[model samples]
Target: MTKAKRTAKKLHHIDRAMSETAAAERQSGPMRVLAAVNELSDQPPLIALSAATLAAGLVLRRPALTRGGARMLASHLLATAIKTAVKRSVDRTRPHSVDDGYDYRLEKGGSRSHHYSSFPSGHTAGAVAVARAAARTWPAHAPAAAVSATAVGAMQLPIGKHYAGDVIAGALIGYAAEAAVGAIEAAVLPAMTRRSAS
Candidate 1:
């Protein structure tokens, strides 16, 4: 065989190996807890809690809590918005949908979240955003925050919600949101404080 043909054969074998590994992980009984963890890390419950915190902070006149709540909500929104747009454009199908022992396809109309929007794990993004914000606010507990974020990421693989690349991309978006929001706060908060004081 020619060199190009040999290289293509090897690449095809590697792709099959990776797909098989991902499928086996989802079926492993020993790692079933990952499914539960994935469910817990979902966006709805977390967002509801954040909303409650925001309401409580406002009612109790707690500025710091209010700010934290606002930031948390903003981070969730940012991650979701980006995730949705990218999923719509990329149109990548879920692994379970694609694992037919065949090829992959990028379909149109990626509005169906459970099926099509699998490129970036929204759950992972939300978890990382919350963890990152907590880490930034309490620098001393950054290690624990990191562990929490990593655990959220770990659940995605065995749960079969996303590929490793998807998780990494989601994490990038999550961390970027944290950095962006922090910069905005650093620049705007001082100005707002000064005006209030005056």
Candidate 2:
């Protein structure tokens, strides 16, 4: 075969191998489980859970649950907004979509296309944000909440949704969102209390 033809044939074989590897990974039982668990972090379910917690708190007359639910919902929403902004600003292909796991494209801005918006993992951001809010309300569960958040972030890797760096950035965004919400509450709640007292 000519040099060009030989090169083409070799490239085809390499692509086939990569495709097989990717398919196998996707079919793994553990990965399937992870993918299912990741769905819990999705917006709809998270929102529903938050609303349920708040409603339960109201009905049971429990201040802690009321505060926890409010904070969880607010922080997750903030985190989602922050991640969406970041995804638009920084473009990177999802790991599963690219041949090279480490390859990423950075540009001035990104499109709304899901394929190119992978700089930060949205699922991880929301998960960590909700976890942080829960931990703040129930300080005793802080450790477990942190671990759960980390697990959610880590699961994004093997499932081919995001890279480690993406998860880390997402976690930071989550933390920032929660901190901002907490700060706002700290500043406003005391004033409201004083006003009510008067």
Candidate 3:
């Protein structure tokens, strides 16, 4: 190769090496911190928050708060269940594990192994579900809730926990779960109210 071409090739390799090193450092520092905070979106804490809101609503005798809590709980549960089912049925390798060629299998004996279960992000699903549920109840806070939920989903990208498509799918699943839960509540609550008044 010509001298100019050799120089350009060396520079490209050097830049790639620097980028890899930087990525390693980031994962050890800010990325780790972010991932840790992201764990708050997990099922246990979310479920606890829902139950606490429910208990507070009951103790304070507030029907709106009670309904909000119930909606949040139901939405999160449904989202999680849907996410789990999708993970089991559609397998996709995580971003970090893509070095060994991308492995994607849909509806073909997909396993729940962490590396292979990266299709629909569970964290994003739960966060979006809770956010949607809260927004449905308090329309004034919808913007803030949406931003928070989007942040949770976006964080998964940098942390190498999910692909963009996975996050998008997760958000859709979460929204649908909340919508379904809301419809069910709408149809049943009035009938139950009528019965109680009888």
**Model 2: which residue pairs collide?**
none
Winner on lDDT (1 vs 3): 3
The reply for model 3, stretches above 4 Å from the true place, is 1-28, 99-107
Model 1, range 20-67, lDDT digits (tens) per residue? 476566766756766765777778976876677678789999976687
Candidate 2, 42-99: lDDT as tens digits: 7788778878888889999999999999999999899999998899898777766664
- Candidate 1, residue 73: the lDDT equals 77
Off by over 4 Å in 1: 1-20, 28-32, 59-62, 100-103, 106-113
- What number of clashing residue pairs does each candidate have, in the order they appear? 0, 0, 0
For all predicted structures, in order, the TM-scores are: 0.80, 0.83, 0.82
Candidate 3 lDDT tens digits, 1-198: 999989976874563344334334336688999889989988998999888887888999998888889999999999999999888888777665553455643335347677788778888999999999999998999999999999999887776777666788899999999999999999999999999999
Name every residue pair that clashes in candidate 3: none
Give the worst 10-residue stretch by lDDT in candidate 3: 16-25
Residue ranges of candidate 2 with Cα displaced over 4 Å: 1-24, 99-104
Arranged by lDDT with the best first, the candidates are: 3, 2, 1
Write the number of the candidate with greater lDDT, choosing between 1 and 2.
2
Please list the C-alpha lDDT of all candidates, in the order they appear. Answer: 0.73, 0.82, 0.82
